[model samples]
Target: MDLNKIHNIYFIGIGGIGMSAIARYFSANGKKVAGYDKVKTPITNSLEELGIRVHFEDGVKHIDLAFLNKEKTIVVYTPAVPSDHQELTYFKNNAYTVLKRSEILGEITKNTFCLGVAGTHGKTTTSAILGHIMEPLKATSFLGGISENYNSNLILGDDKVSVVEADEFDRSFLRLSPNIACITSMDPDHLDIYDKPDALQESFKEFAGKVTDTLIVAEGLPLEGLTYGFGDSAAYQALNIEIKNGGYFFHVKTPTRLIKEIEFYLPGRHNLMNALAAFAIADVYGVSSDVIKKQLASFKGVKRRFSYKVKSEKIVLIDDYAHHPTEIKAVEASVREMYPGKKVLAVFQPHLFSRTRDFIEDFANSLSKFDEVLLLDIYPARELPIKGVTSGWLMEKMTLQNRKLISKVNLSEEVLKSEADVVVMIGAGDIGLMVDDVKFRLEEKFSLLK
Candidate 1:
């Protein structure tokens, strides 16, 4: 399908991070853009502010008349949307040119020099960093999270190059034809879709095969590529890492050159690795080491990827989108490294039932690293609840002595009771939406004590 021939673009789940990026892309390119989401959000609000039509209801009437013309309009929907969704069904039954979010992205970037960042974790940060590094070259980046530097997911650039989060959900990355790509990890996730760890690994290998120019992999991953990590044997290695002034200062050894004293502000060894990946990709694309170092230093980071909501001498409040066991462990390590000798409280909401059931023990063990734990019910983003799988069950498996199963209704009250010096809210669901309320209450209560 020729996107140039299309005049109106509609999305069934336009409020999603990825979907909204595409919506903004079309809107910026002068296409009549609109969509339907199950609910209104800050993302939907932003779209409305751009003069794009958005409505929460699922009826066909909510769609503007311009979008009803099948010849000129193409519909895009996320895999997370229900199969029976009214707007999606209407578009399909009406024989509109419908495509998945990945398909549309594939179409947009197929002809460009696409730098696809693929993995279970770190995709968002890695892609955002790459986008920032490549901004001088006019690379359009469609990121999975809000870049703190740009304040928007869509980093609008020219048509010659594109940066994208090569997602593995539903094997969506398979649709993209990339000139260069990197696999940050091959961790087993989305068990509801893959059902087996090997299947997920196979998908990564398939994506790696699609990279036409270069494939960069994290050190110790199963894929064979120009490796990047802290180890001496990796092609792109971050050596002599040190933490100072709330950030990392390190030297990177590329295949051809040694980039020295690169300063990165994002906390965590995992994030250091993410920076390394971005640096490797940009270096391969012929960006100067000095330019990559400058961009990495300037990149603020993606929102909710260890975002500091409240920070002071008395208390520190952090919000992160770490629903996976490995991600939680990374967050825990970063917190412990940043604030030693401080009592830490972790409030977690599991993301999906299949994921919770598949990795319950792992989740419990990871959360146990905190001094205190508050477990909320599973978010169940796209899956029905499984019998006997719940937060209470997860709480029982945790080794933490100070752990409680709490509800959102009483989140602020329970959090206020904690004597912990650091409070971290971790999840990928509406719990993110609840952080402002929790932050407000925490500030109010703590100020009274002062």
Candidate 2:
């Protein structure tokens, strides 16, 4: 579809991170933009601040008259939206052009030199780092998460180059045509959609086939590509790693040369690998090693990837979007590494009932590493509860001695009861919305003790 011919773009789920980025892109390009979401959020507020009209209700009357013109308008909806959604159904019944969010992203980046970052995890951080490195090249980046550096998911630039987080949910990444791409991992996730781990692997292989110029994979992944990792066999390897002052200082060996004294601020070995992946992609694109190193050092990070809400010597609080078993283990390792000998409390909200049921034992084992655990009810974003999938059931499977199933209303009280030195709240759902209140109560309680 020729986007130039479309003057008005209406989004059915405008508050989503990916959808809002596309909305901002069209709004910035002088298109008349508006949309409807089921709830108002910070994302919708930001869109409204840009003069884009957004409403919470989902009705035909809520849509502006200008967006009703079928010839000049197109409707974009996310896969998470229900099929019976009123606005989406209205657009379909009226024979208006309706497309999935992934289809529109594919169209937007089709002609550009696209750098797609695909994986079950680490895609957001890797893509954000690559976007920062490519900013001088005038690359427009559509990120899956808000970048702390740019403070927006859409990093505006010229249309010649584009960086995007190629999502694997619903096989969305298959729609993207990338000139250069990287698969950070192929962990078995979204089991509700793929039903088996092998199918997910095959999907990644299919996406690998679509890479026109280059495909980079993490070492040990079952794909043929220039590899990046800490091992000596990788095409791009990070050597002599050192952690000091809560960041990493390392040297890198590229295909052509050795770069010395590369600095990156994000914590965790998983994050170090993310940085290496981005560095390899940019280096292959002909960006100078020195320039990439400089950008990596200056990169802040993506919001909620490991955001520090409150950091002090006496009390520490961290928020992260780690919903998968592997991701939770990575966060646990990072916390143990950062605060050695200190008691750490992990307050976690399981994301989906199917996911929790599929990996119940794995989730229990990962959450057991913390000194204390407070489990919240599963945040069922797109799925209903299974027969026996519940937080209490999962908590019973955990071996951790100091674990309890808690309610959101008593979250702050339960958290304050723990005398742990550090508190980490991990989830992908509305637990993010609860972090601020938790932080405020923590500060107040600590101040009273002082």
Candidate 3:
């Protein structure tokens, strides 16, 4: 399918972070863009403000007649969409040029100098950093999360170079043809799709083989690649790491020269690894060490990836898109490291029932590390409720006696009344949308108490 011939791009799940980026890309390039989402989010609203039509209903009737032409319009959908989605079924049955979001991204990057970032976690932050590094030279990036620096998930540039998060869900990363790529960590996730851990690893190994240029991996990954980490042996290493100014101050030892005194604004050792991966990829593109160092320090980070909402002395509130056990642990470590001796309360909303059921023990152990835990019902993004799997069930398994299961309706009130010195909201679900409201309510509550 020649993109030049396609006049309109329609997204079935347009409000998704990744999908909305592509929608913006097409709309900017003279393609009439529009689509459907199940709910109205800031993302959907942003798209509407960009002159792209967005409807919340699932009916084909809502699709404009201009997009009904099979030959001139391309229909892009995320794998998260249900098989029975009415608009999706209509496009398939009507012989429209349908493509998955990953497939469209692959087509977009095939000819460009593509820098693909793949991992179970840290992909968004790493890609956002890499995109910022390459932005001076005009590299377009379709990120999984909105960058605080750019204020948008898509960084528009000439088609010469591209940066993207090579997603692992549904084996989507395999479709990308990256000129240079990095695999941050190949942890077993989405077991509901892969069924087993080995199958998940196998998928990553396969994606690694598709890289046309350099392949960078974390120090301990099984695959033989240019490794990046803190240790001495890796090709790109961050040595003498120190936490300063509530951020990381580190140096990168490239295979060529020692880049000294790099300033990173994000917290945690996991983020250090993410920075190293991006630095290695940028190094491969012959970007100067000084330039890489400056770009990194200036990088603000993604919206929900350890984003701080209120950092005042009176109250501290942070939000993160951490749903996995490893990510949750990293968040806990960072919070505890930053505000030691402070009572930390973690408000967690489990994303999917299958994920909660699969990582029951892991989730319980991670959440127990917090001083107090408040859990909301599972978001159930795409799945029906599991028989015995629930947030209440997961909270009961937690060893922490300070845990409470609450509904979204009571979440604001409960959070406002909590005495914890630091509050961190952790989840990949709609819980993120409530962060602003929670912050406002907390401020009001503090004023009343005063």
Candidate 4:
């Protein structure tokens, strides 16, 4: 679809991170923008402040009459939205030029130099770090999560280059045409859609084939591409890693030269690998090694990916969007590495019912790594609850003795009652909404102790 003819863009689920990025893109380009979300969030509020109309109601009346014209208006919706959504149905029945959020993103990046970062894990951080590296080139980044450095998911810049998190959910990344693509990891996830792990891997292989230019794969991903990891022999690698002042000071071996003493603020070996993938993309794009190192040091992480809420000595609280087993394992390893011998408490809210059922054993094993575990009822973002697949079921499978199923109402209280030195809230669901409450209560409790 030729975008020039479209005058107005209406979003059915604009509050979503990816949808909002595209909404901002259209609004910035002088198109009349408005959207309907089931709930209003800080992201939707930000859009409203930008002169874009946002309504929380899911009714068709909330949509302005100006967008009712099928000829001049374009409709975009997230796959998360139900098929029976009134506003979405109205657009479809009226023959409006409706497109999925990914389709719109594909259209936007088709003519530009697109850099896509894809994986079951680490895609957001990799894309964010890559965006930082390509800042000198003024690349527009449509991130899956808000970057702490940019404070927004959409990084507006010239159309010379675009950086995006190629989401594997619903195989949405297939729509993108990237000049340089990086696959951070191809872990099995979203089993509800893929039905099996092999299907997910095949989808990734197909995605690998779509890379218009260079394809950078993480080490050991069964695909043909230049690899990046801690291994010295990898095409791009981070070696001789040392911890200084709670940050990683490491040397990266590029194909041409060995870049030394790069400073990275984030924790976890997984993050070092994420930075390596981004560095490889920068190198492939001909960004100088010195500039990559400099930009990487200043690159702050994404909002909820291992975000530190309280970093004091008395009580440490961190929040992360780690619903997957591998991601939770990464978070646990980072916490243990940073505060060795400390009693770590992990509060996890399972994201989807199918996911909970698919990786029950893996989830139990990962959560058991913590000293104590608090499990919240499944978040059920886009799935109906699977019978017998509850948090209690998961808790029972866990090897840890100090584990209990808790509700959001009792989340902070349970954390305060635990004898843990470090608290980490891990999930991709509404558990993030409780971070401030948990942090405030923990702070108050620690202050009273002092």
Candidate 4 C-alpha lDDT tens digits along 199-256: 9999999999999889999998899999998776688888889988888998888777
Model 4 deviation from the true structure expressed as Cα RMSD, one decimal place? 1.3
Better of 2 and 3 by TM-score: 2
The positional error of residue 25 in candidate 2, measured at the CA in angstroms, is: 0.6
TM-scores, in order shown?
0.98, 0.98, 0.98, 0.98
* lDDT for each candidate structure: 0.93, 0.94, 0.92, 0.91
Q: Candidate 3 lDDT, tens digit per residue, 19-125?
A: 99999999999999999999999999999999999999889888899999887899999999999999999899988889999999999888899999999999999
The digit string of per-residue lDDT tens for model 2 on 225-256 reads 99999998999999999998899999999988
* Model 1 ranges off by over 4 Å: 448-450
Worst 10 residues of 4 by lDDT: 441-450
Clash pairs of candidate 1?
A: none
Candidate 3, superposed: residue stretches over 4 Å from native: 448-450
Q: What does candidate 1's lDDT look like per residue over 1-450, in tens digits?
A: 788999999999999999999999999999999999988899999999999889888898778898999999999999999999988988899899999999999999999999999999999999999999999889999999999999999999999999999999999999999998999998889888898659999999999999999999999998888999988899999998999999999999989878898999999989999999999999998998888888988989999999998888878899999999999999999999999889999999999988898999999899999999998999988788899999999989998889998899999899989999999999999889989888888888778334
